[model samples]
Every structure is written in structure tokens, then in C-alpha cells.
Target: MLHGSDTKYRMFRAALLRGRTWLTPVCALACATVGASWFIADTMVERIAMVGSVLASASTAVFFAVQLAREVNRRNERLLALAGIVETTGDAVVAAKLDRTITAWNSGAENLFGYTAEEMLGQSVQRIVPAGDTTSLQANLDHMLEKDGMHTYEVKRQRKDGSLVDVEITLSPLRDLSGDVVGISSIIRDISERRQFEGEREQLLERERDARRDAEYARSLVEEQNRHLVELDPMKDDFVASVSHELRTPLTSINGYLDLMLEDDEDFPATQRQYLGVVRRNSERLLRLVGDLLFVAQVDAGRISLEMTAVDLTGLVADAVEGVRPVAEEKHLELVADVEPIEIPQADALRLGQVLDNVLSNAVKFTPAEGSVSVRAFLDGTHAVVEVEDTGMGIAPEDQARLFDRFFRTAAAGHMAIPGTGLGLAIAKAIVEGHDGTISLASEPGQGTTVRLELPAQSGSTESARYVETLL
Candidate 1:
């Protein structure tokens, strides 16, 4: 039995169809009545009156019949056009009875659901609905009945193979001739590709968010480490300063007493004299080591003072070369110098001497027997250039990167048992930079090394002096 609303729709359809079925019979009866009225006329006036009345009534019925036929033809043409459109369209067009029974299925529906019209017709609409979505389908139907109009929504529908697809379905009411809704017509569009693209876009956004979070976390860690280093730097400087001062006091006294005993060594045995000399030399070395440590600490604390004076840079290089030449001679290494007499307008002659001494000393100390060490000084425009080249065991590629870091010894130096504190180049760098100068080194393993220094020829202004002082 149909529901109350379904019964009403069926009754309205039946009454409307009965009325249309009787229209032609009524027209035929009107024609028969006109023929009888003409045959029964007796007098001339009566016959004319009957013919006129019958003719008028027959003409009215004929006009109505023609109008009805025209309206029916127009409606038939409209239905044919709509059917053609539904069959050819890409979107699925489906028609179902109010009881949810499938009535019509287009080619599009067959292609989308993998089911032919023959198989779907007379079947319940739930045949294509997923198990989880049956309730939703009923709800949609109820909503359509309540609204009494068209509605569109998205849902997942299962194909004949049981695979689900995303679809957009628009449901519209199908009405009878008496304007009573008896079925539902649905237009379904596949939306699988759009849904897939949206899913990928969301995943990409989530990945980008994760990357941003990781980057922020790394930056925060780096900042925290830098703060920790800054806090520990002062404590490190104080410890170095205290230790150097304590060592230097004892070292000075040892050197003084050793010097006195070495001078009077002839009064003792030769072995004792030799022992005293060893003690004296070791004391001097220890004292020098302590002094270098103190200097490094002072530089770290920005306590280095420079005494600016006009001086000849070439003369300074020449003096340092002479001082280290003895060491070169002892190693049987060739020492050479080329100075092109250039003067600096304002510089700390003493500090410049220390930088040159460190560089020249390293050259002489590292060169093998018969190897060559050369020093060159000249003026390049407004700058003074000094270059030192040595045919020594050159630094390795990896070690050259950190060659100027304090106390950083190279693998090659350690292997060869070369004596050094590794503070010379670092100190030289600080002093050269204090004068607003630049220094660079180039070397290759087993080949040679070249140290280059470029300093401003003239920086005599008071502001320049103050700026240079602050650097150290």
C-alpha cells in the first residue's frame, strides 16, 4: 500500500489522465448531436434555426479540439527534447518513484555506476548507495519532500564493483499533470579529482608548517648557545690572566738565579756547568711562554696599547730579517731580503716589529736544510705591501683554514716535532688589524708558503688613531 502522500499523488494522476481520455469522446458526441438536430428540422425557419445553433456549437468544439491538439504536440516536443538532453549529457540523470524505486537511468548513469539501465530499472535506489550512506540518502529524500523543490548536496556513492566515488547530486521534484509530486529526478556529477587535489594541497600546507616550526626551533637553539658562550668568555679570560701572572713571577726568579750560576760555571765541574746552562735556557723559554699567554689575555680583554710613530716599514722588515738570519744560517737555509724603502706616516713601530718578527721567525724555523726564505717590501699606491715566502714543509689544505686560531697546532707540525705555541700568527693578526691592515697566507703541502701584509701608508688623523686603539 502507498503512503498517505503517495496515495494522494496516485489519485490526482488517475483523475487527470481520465479527464484527458474523455476529451475526444466529448468532441465526437457534440458532432453527433449537431447531425441529429439538422435531420429533425421540419419547417424552413426551424431548419435554419437548428442549423445555425448546431453549426455554432460544432465550430466552438472544433476550435477547442484543435487548440488541445496543438498544446499536446508542443508538450510532446518538449518531452522529446528533454529526453534527448538527458540521454546525451555527461552528468548522470536518474528518475526514481516516491517509494525510492528506480524508474529511469541515462547512459551517463550507466557509465558512472558501471550498471546498465536494464539492470537498474525497477531496483531500489539503495542498490547504488553505500552501506554507511543509506541513512543519508533517506534523509535527502525526506528533505526534498519537505522543501518541495530542488536541492543539491555531495556524498559518496558506490559503483557496481563496490568502489565508492565522490559525487555532487542535485535532486528535483518530478510532478504529475495536476501539479502533484510523484517522483524525484537527480543530476549526479563526479567530484573525485577535485577531492584528491584538495587532499594533496592540505598535506603540502601541513608539511610547510612543520618545516617552519623546525627552523624556528633551530634558530632558538643557536641563540641560546651564543648567549652561553658570551657568559663563559669573561671567566675564561680571568683564569688565563691569573695563571700567567703566577707563572711569570716564579719563572722570572728562576731565570735570574740560573743566569747568575751560569756566569760562575767555570768554578764548578763541566757537567755541572752544562746542567746549569740547560736550566737557564729552560727558564728563559718558560718565561717567554708565560709572557705570550699574558699578551694573548690582554688582547682578548682589549687592553693592548699602541704607540703610534712615523717609521720606515722597509727598515723594520730588514731588521727582523737580520734577527732571524742567524737561525736560518744554523739550519743551512738561504735567507734573502728585497726592501723598496717605504715609510708609514703613523703606526706603532714596536707592534709592527713584533708582527714581522713572528712571520720571519716561522719562515726560518720551518725551512729544511738548503731551502730558501725570502722577504719583500714595497709601496703599492697608498698602501705598504710586505710579502714573505719560504720553501718549508707547507701547511696542509685542511689545517690552513684554522692556521691563525690560538693554540691550534697542525697535524704536520706535530708529526715533525716542530716546537711552537701556535700563538704567533694569531697575535700577528690582531696587531696588523689594529693598524687597519690586512694579512693573508697561501700554501700547499710539500711545496711552499707565502704570507702577505697590506697596510695603509698614511693614517695620521686623530680619529684614525683612536679607532685603531679601540680595535686592540
Candidate 2:
């Protein structure tokens, strides 16, 4: 398995030796016969032998000449094929001398530069190079001359029509038989369209970067606004707490005087007594509203402290049902209580009671005459569960989601002029959650409402609450 170069070398040597093979042997034989004929005194035979030797030498020379001619023809064919390829290639192929004078130019070069080979041959390569770029071009050529391989660069060149063309040129050092760099051979390609495409791609990339910058700026603005809101939340809570505390002192005095006036009917006339009753009722409502606001403020500020202790949930439910019984009786509604004794080992009894009272009162308040409001208390797994189900006018689906939002009143309650501050459920939820519990409601419009309270049997300690506040 001879390699390509080895096989060609072997074939060339075989061709060179083909004429010498039999001719060398024939010449040797003729000389031997001539020497033998001289001993036998045959001059004619010697002369014939000498002529045959001459003929053999001439034949050998002719054969060698024919072999050399064949070798030359093969090399010329290979050169013709290379020339055809260079002539037909799409890239401009040009060969220049060390002096920067053009030696050969292909048809591609002609098409690119609008100059035929006849017109460009022997001309200085600088003729096509833009005047502003000659220094850079010379530097590249100098580098190619110093190096052994190829050097490629982009250049702006002028065509014969004086139009600028973007070209990418690869310059390689052309070597002679002795392996010395003699000239440079270059392959040039027109890259105007490629340059245009690159420009468009860069523009698109820049636009994308700009859009990303704008989005980042918008996000930063939103984040800043969120930070401001977070800072202002506690301030708003503080303001509500301060305002409620300030109003509570005056409200308490007004309610007390009104109660005193209403209780004493001898000093006050009938009309005066009625006015005092109205004032007292309105004053009590205002006082309740202020208490609710203060409680909500404390919850939001994470300052609502709970005294955790073991307590019977059954007793709490019973008391809460009794507390709301008078309101249910006033509306002629039935108040039913089903209590199963369950002890919460760790809980805020006061807060838990408050949650129940809020829920039961709401049940009694919303139920119409003869409607039943059922309160159930039991143990569910590790939790103490309290459910208040009422045959009241239920909340709409849209309103149900925000039922526990502070100061959010339902449309039906507002239209009916029901006495409410809408802060009951919100405060109840805060109290329940502060004691490590959850409160949820399920209701449908015109159907009924069910409020379920689930509290952890073993509530979190004060230290855990402090840690939660710190996180907030």
C-alpha cells in the first residue's frame, strides 16, 4: 500500500529506467562480441559490432528522450487543470511580485475590479488599493513576506469604475523550488453584502440591549415604590392607633354622661330622656368602632400580646353563644350550640374568646327572623375546631374573598343599613392568626354562610411570636 507521493515517485523511476533495461545489456553483449572478433582477426565483425553498439546507445537515448517528453506532458496537463480551476473560481485570485507588481490575475479578479488580466498585469497592486489604506495594506504584505503561511484581512478597495468595494483578502507566501518566498498569492472575496448583514445584526443586538436596560429601569422603579410602601405601612398603623387612643378618652366621658342622663328620668323630661338614649347608643357605637380601629392597629404593628394558658374550648363556645343570644332573640332567630369538651393546652383564652364572639355575633346579626345559627366546637386531629353555620343571607362570591379585609362592607349590609363597622371579621382573623390559628369562610349568595376557625392545640410560645415579628 504505497502512498500517493511514493507511488508517483516509483512510477517516474520505472519510466526513466525502462529504456536502459534491455539497451544496457545489448551494448554489453556487442562489446564482448567485438573483443572476441578482434582475436579471430575479423575486422568486418568488429565494425558491425561497433555499429550495433552505436545503434543501441542511440535507441537508449531516444527512449530516454521519449520518457522525458511524456513526463513533461503529464506535468503540463496538471498545470492546465490548476490554471482552469484558478480561472473559474468565484474568488479573485491574484499573484504579485515582492515589489507589489501584479504577475497574474484571474477572471474573478477581472469581474471584481473591472480590469482584465491584460490591463492589470505588470501594474502596481496599489492601483486597486484605496489611497487611505495603502499603509495598512503594505504592513499586511510585509507580514506575509516575513511569515510562511497565510494572512487574511478585510480591506476597502476601489474598482476601475471608482466605486468602493469591501473585500476579504487571504494572502499567502508563494515559494520557489528552493523553498524561498518569492511572491504572494492572494484570494479575495467581495464581502459587501456580508458587511451589510453584520451591520443589521449589530443594530438588532443594540436594540435588544436597550430594551433590556429599559425593563431593568422599570423594575428598579417598581422596587423603589414597593420599599416606600413597606416603610409607610407601619407609620399608617401608628397614626390609626394614636388617633383611636386620643378619641377614646373623650368618647368614654361622653358615653358616661349620656348613660347618667338616660338613667335619671326625674331630672330630665320625656323628650330629653329620649335624646339622651339616642346619644348614648350612638356614643357606644362610636366607642366600639374606635376600639376596633385600635385593635387592628395593634395587630398590624405586631404589638398585640397574648396571655397563653390552657382553657376548655367548650366553655368558650358556650359563653360566646350566650353573649350573641340576645341579638338572635331580638331578630326572632334560633341560636343552637353543640359543644364537645376539648382542652387547648396552650392558647390565648381571651383572644380565642374574642374570635368566637365576633363570629357568633356576625351569625346572629345576619340571620333573618326564624333562621337558625348553629355553633359547633370539637377536636379535629391536633386542632381545636369551631364552626359557625348560619341560615343568613350569604355573601356573593366576589365579596367573599375580601370578607376579612379591614373596613370592607358588603353591598347587602350597606343597603340594609345594618349596624356594622366591617372590621369585625378582620380583627377576628388577626386575633385567631396571632394565636397560631386560621379562620376561613364559605358562603354563597342567598344560600348561607359558614365560618370555620381552626387553632393549633399547642400554640406557639411568646419567644416564637417575637421571632415572627422580627422577621416582619
Candidate 3:
């Protein structure tokens, strides 16, 4: 006595064994009708008697056959729908036997490989695999058999046109009703564009690395050159200092002898005295140049020593004015001094005098005859301020920025042949800043020039003063 489920199972098994075709379903329907009629005839013939019994059995057989046919039709409809889905997909769908021979090809396969189903079916799958990639394909197949389900991998495949393409393939084992592996069904997608993009990205990264290496090498070269310049700077300064010292003694003797000769005018002729005056003037100019060079060397070597003491800032300005007054008179330029009585708590009086002398002399030298130079001193907040304004050939705007650089002269001064070593303002700046002070300039090319010095009311600490002196 078979259960209903067992009966259906047996029927389906028998149908499958016969093959899934139009004739197989028809044969199943006929077998079902015959079995129903035989059972009815044996069981109900005696109960219903004669003609009525035969009619009931015939009706029952017809009903069973219709139901069986409907069931078969429903199963066939589902299978056909699955086949349609596999055929219409965009990726190539292939079925192959375990022996690696192609069993089925769909429209997608035809479009992708340029091969028609008629040409590819029953052909070896290796026809599409590149020669160098066959070993890898074989290994993948072996792995799929051991896993017994589904596997995916990437490979290079040859097209029907003999061109190679990168492809990703997913393989699933096909099984029979008893769950035995029969063949493999594969889904293949072309990935040539993706692989090309990856290759280009790798190339770009390598270029970036090369560019970075080149930039680092250039930076290292620049740094090395800078270090060499720094090392050579001190040696140059020392050489200048040594040569200036050697020239100083001879220049002093020449100037002294010229002055003595000019004094003995009665013993010398008048024309001779004029020539001696010219020599004396030039000798003095050379002496000033040598002095400037020595000062610069001392500043560079950090050897400047200051003797600090209390001083009257007003007195210093008045004395510097008096010292430059003779030169101003010679040019017929008026010299004005507006001195305020301010006591500097600590200062190097001699060095402060030198700073004022340098600034005032420049004002006198550059000012034309009849032009006026004024010196003003005052106290502002916690700082002492001194200003020197001159009606002179003012510095050009471009040259003004480098005015305090050693040996830097203005273009106008050079054009006029105004004799100068161009170290006046530079030395003044160093002295002022050494006392923790600031010096600034304001000028216009045609108008005039004004210089301002601002000093702390109290001098900087001794250590800071020394540090500033070294920097100067």
C-alpha cells in the first residue's frame, strides 16, 4: 500500500527515466488512466453491477488522465521559463560535460565569442582558453570537482577572432535527479576594460614616485650649496680685517707728513701748498675708508666692547651738531639742533657719540649749499627718541631698502660723485641696535630724508646687548 506522496514520487521517477520530452508526459498520462480503470473494474464491478459500473469506471479513468496531464504541463512550463531566463541573460552561459566538451551554448555566448551555437556545441571548451592559460583552467576544473558545488575565477580566454580577453567565470556543477554530477554550467563575463583601467592606474603611481624622488634630490642639492656658502663667509670677513689693519699705519704717516708740510707755508711756495692740500685731502679719504673696513670687521667677528655709563642724551646731540657745523658752514647750509634734556640711565657715551657723528656727517655731505639739516631729541613713553631730518638729495625708493647694508650706496650719490665709503648708516644702525634700540628711515626721492632712532629708556641686559652686538 503506497502513500499518495510515494505514488507521485514513483511516477515522477519513471517519467524522468523516460526523458523529459512531449512523448514522456503523454505516456505517463496513459499509464495513469490504465491503472485507474483496472483498479475500478476489480473493486466496483460486483458492487454496482453491469452497465452502471462500467460507466463509473470509465469516467474515473478519464478524470485521472486529465489531472496527470495538467500536472505534467505545469512542470514543463516552469522548466521552459528557467531555460528562457538562462538564454536571455547578458553574460555568456555555457554547459559542458565532465569530459570538458561543450554541451550547450546560448545567444549570449554566440554574441560574446562570435561563435554560433551550431559551431560551438560538442566542441572542446579548451578552444576558447588561451594556450598559456590552459594549465590554470585545468586546475580550476579540478578544484570545482572536489568542491562539488560552485566556483568563480578569472582567466585569459581567446575569442573566435583570435584576440585575447580577460574574463571572470563562475562554474556550477549540474546534477541528475539522484544528485550525481553530470556536467558543469558556467557564467562568463568579459573584464578587459576593468583590467586596462587597473594597469593605467599602476603606471600613474610609478610616475608619481619618480617625481617625488627627483624633487627630494633637488632640495638636497640646494641645502648642500647653502651650507658651503655659510662656511666660506667667516673666512672672507677675516681676510678683509687683516688687509685693512696692514694699510692703516702707512696711510696715517702719509696724512701726518702732508699736514706738517702744509703748515710750513713760508718755507714752501704757494703753488706747492695747493698740491699738498689735494694730496692731504685724498689721504684723509683713504684713511676714512680703511677705518670703515676695520669697523665692519670688528662687528662681523663679534668683538665690539661697550663701556656703559650714565649720559645726557641732549649733550650728545649738541656736540655732534657742533662737530658738523664747520662742514655745514663750508657748504653754506644751515645746521639746527633741537635738544631735549633726557638722561639715559645706561649707555656707552663714546659709541653713542660715534652714532650721532655718522648720521650728522651724512646729512651735511648730501645737503646742497643753502639747504638746512635739523637734529631733534625728545622722550616718548618709555623710550628715548632722536630724529635727524636733512634737506639733501634723498635716496631713491629702490635703493632705500638696502641703505643699511654694508658698502651699499645710493644711485643719486654715486651720480653726484659725493665721496663716501657708504658705511655711515650701517655702522650707526649696529650701534643703536646693540643698546636694544631701533633705527628707521622715511624719505622721498625729490623731497628729503629723515632718520629716527628709538632706544629703550633702560638699557637691555648685558647678555642681550652682547648677543645683539654679535648679530650686527
List lDDT for all candidates, in order. 0.79, 0.77, 0.77
How far residue 142's Cα lies from its native spot in candidate 1, in Å, is 5.3
Off by over 4 Å in 3: 1-134, 140-204, 219-234, 265-286, 318-337, 357-375, 388-426, 441-450, 458-472
TM-score of candidate 1 to 2 decimals: 0.72
Model 3, position 88: C-alpha lDDT score: 98
Instruction: Count clashes in each candidate, considering only residues at least 3 apart in sequence or on different chains.
Output: 0, 0, 0
Query: Which parts of model 1 have CA positions greater than 4 angstroms off?
Result: 1-91, 140-152, 172-182, 193-197, 265-289, 365-369, 392-402, 405-422, 443-447, 458-472
Model 2 ranges with Cα > 4 A deviation: 1-57, 84-90, 98-132, 157-166, 177-182, 190-238, 264-282, 309-312, 315-337, 341-346, 360-374, 389-426, 441-450, 456-472
- lDDT of candidate 1 over 1-472, digit per residue (tens): 1122665334433433233322112221344454422211122333334443654655543343344445555666788899999999999999999898999999999999999999999999899899876478889888988898998899999999999999999999999766999999999999999999999999999999999999999999999998998899888889989999999999888888877887887889999988888888788888878878888998999998889989877668877987887788788877778767577987999889989999999988888888988888767889988899999999888999899899998998898899999998998998899999998999988898999999989433332211100000
Q: Which ten residues in a row have the lowest lDDT in candidate 1?
A: 463-472
Q: lDDT of candidate 3?
A: 0.77
TM-score of each: 0.72, 0.64, 0.65
Candidate 3 clashes: the total is 0
